[model samples]
Target: MKPIFKRPRFGTTSTAFWAATIGLLLIIAAVAGWPNPVIFVMGAILLATGLLIWQEITAGLWIGLSVFGLLTVLHLTRAATYFQLRYLIYSLAFAQLGYECWRGLQRTRDGIDSEDIDDENGDGEEDKPMISLVLLQRQPKYLENMILTKVVESAWGGDYSNSDAQSDDDADDGDGFVVGESPMFVIKAPAGMFLVHNFDVPYWDNKDEVVEAIGELRLRNAVEEHTAWLSVDMLTPGDEEPDLNEAYLLVAKLLTALADEDTLAVVRPESLDLNVWSDDVVARLLTPGAYEELSLPDNAPVIPIADDAPEMRAAIATAQQRWPEFADAFQQRASHDKADDGPSFVVKAKITAGDSTEFIWVDVIGLEPKFVHGHLANDPVALGDLKLGSQVEFPIEDVCDWCYEKDDEPVGLFSLEAIRQIQEAQQTNEQ
Candidate 1:
């Protein structure tokens, strides 16, 4: 039997407090010349705490505190005479831990870097510009953490930022500077393309300060049709959300420059015209029953469904009589889906198209007409291209035998609007 492991529950603040307490006790015990076993246990507890709940600055502070506490205790007790060679070695270990903590602080300030590439569809090649691209930048503050801390707290996901306490206007106090919304633009002509450049706005402490920071960060750039991406440093501190209107205007000005091919030879851009696609055309393609009338079946059960369907047995029996050489083969295929209770039905028949007669398996599922309304199924390559998921009028002489079934119970699917309502209801229940 496999053993089940429950997730560990550790509150961030509580864990930090306990880790600091244990570290302090360990430092005191080591300095006070406590019993070997007692000092060893304290050291173990301190190590576990540091490993579990670690923040760079907090860990650094704890290490510094412990080192200073140990030094103070040694000075009080004549360290030269009272401390043995082993005790000196223990101090060196404490120094090492302190040094590691210092290194961690430096790493946190440096921040971390991450990169992801979007090659349009899952395909490797990047050719035409009809591809839509979006850039999402998650600031370093969110990602900078030790691997252990990240793994342990991954399930308890939350934004650990002062942004929550900050009012939108607080970041706006400086020189009316604001981080604007992500910019979106369309490049037409040579290739149809849509691009969204998401700019992260670091905390704007003051307008002049932010302006200087933006310059230092190299936030200014002309957007071109061929422009692949915009880069920002990990050290940049940005607001949670920026002003969209400003961002849109900034992109618009850049777009105008790109359109002027006379000056900029690389890009041959035109004015973005999105009104070309008519609402009616879009509705026809997306709205159920708008493009093609639905093909729904009546509730009437024309034949036994599933295993009870006589057509399956009849087809096999007839095949065996007509083609004795292939009787076993025919029976083998017919034996499938022989259950009395099932949503599917199996039928076999010889279909004639043009001059050729082909034997094929006819698999059918019970999809009530009401539930599958406004849907049409058609084969682009076949001669009878319009009969895929469309409504079928019953009593067709061509269909020698068919099993029919109606949906009397809910089958766990709904339209777009119905789905929205269900989601709202679920949210209400959760609340």
Candidate 2:
């Protein structure tokens, strides 16, 4: 058997290949009826061939059925005896199986042509940490951005936009703010990071001319009453020299004079070691007898409005008769006790004198009708040591009720007048 062994192959040409394959299948099928162990041997051969090339086996079977089907139809029409019904059925089955195998082979060989494309979220790059200081000192010739940056970084670990507008930016802000020592120690403050700057007042001759002291007093008052922080400061001698030594003395004097435990102010300048503010400056302004109504500061001009002096009662009545519009303005203001013991009026005057402009308010004050003094906006020249009455042309400040309180930040001068009226009415019986 080893000597006679041979490997069978398919085809010499395309037509011959098909014919041989068909012939080989036919021979294998009929070989089962032969003598010896031929049927078993053929079965073994078929199984072995199928195992070796299952795809080919199934394809051959399909083709055989297709041919059988075509041949069976013709054979039946012709009444052919070669067309046995059982053989025809077997042929059909084999042909179908062979066609299925061919289709499977084509599908596997062709493969599912596809391209793998992946976009990893196309996960974006990680976000960057915020910059703590972003000072935009546009055309900042004098003020250094670095100074603000360091100041911010040294104290608070936050962000900074501008030197003044922190919190808005993403920069480190110092934990505490440092108060300036001098003329800059004044300014009206509502909120407190306890900071201040940006002021241009008439240049000061005397230290009192600087507004820091007045600002501190207002701050102390606000703090006691509202428990709010006030960044009150005026212009200092120079931006360069913060001189905390002088600052310390002045602070001690100012605090000792203004100390009201209800209000507290802490100062921290880079001039101090470590720049930490721990101590309290005395609230010297809190001295009991020290509380004085904000009045016309001494040296304020005196504009008399009386025959002997100004008849405020008659003048007010006369004003109502003359400037009826102002009369309405006054009445709307004084709702509760507007009706006097008699008639009232509104008096108005327009004055243009020198560089300073002022609004002089008048009504009955004491026995004489004098200038109504409260918080009046005047150019430095207006508040003067005037010569006897140098024909001082006194006009009302253009305090159109709208721009009265530094433009409504504080109430208008009228509110103060209302308060005065209340005070006067309360004290009239005493007088």
lDDT of each: 0.31, 0.31
After superposing candidate 2 on the true structure, give the runs of residues whose Cα lies further than 4 Å from its correct spot: 1-284, 287-353, 364-382, 386-431
Per-candidate TM equals 0.17, 0.17
lDDT, candidate 2, 1-431, per-residue tens: 11222211121111222334344433444553244455444444434434333323334434443443454464454333543233333344344434434543453355421111112432111111111101111111121334433433333334332333223121233333332221122111111222222112211234244333332232222222332221222222111233333333332333332223432223222121110011211222223321121121222333322222223444344443433344344445456563453233322233335664333432311111223222222212234543222333222332222111122353222323533554466469767
Looking at candidate 2, the ten consecutive residues that score lowest on lDDT are: 129-138
State in Å the error of residue 203, model 1: 36
TM-score of 1: 0.17
Q: Per-prediction count of colliding residue pairs?
A: 13, 55
lDDT of 1 by residue, 111-184 (tens): 52111112334321112122111111223112222321222123123321211113434423322111112221
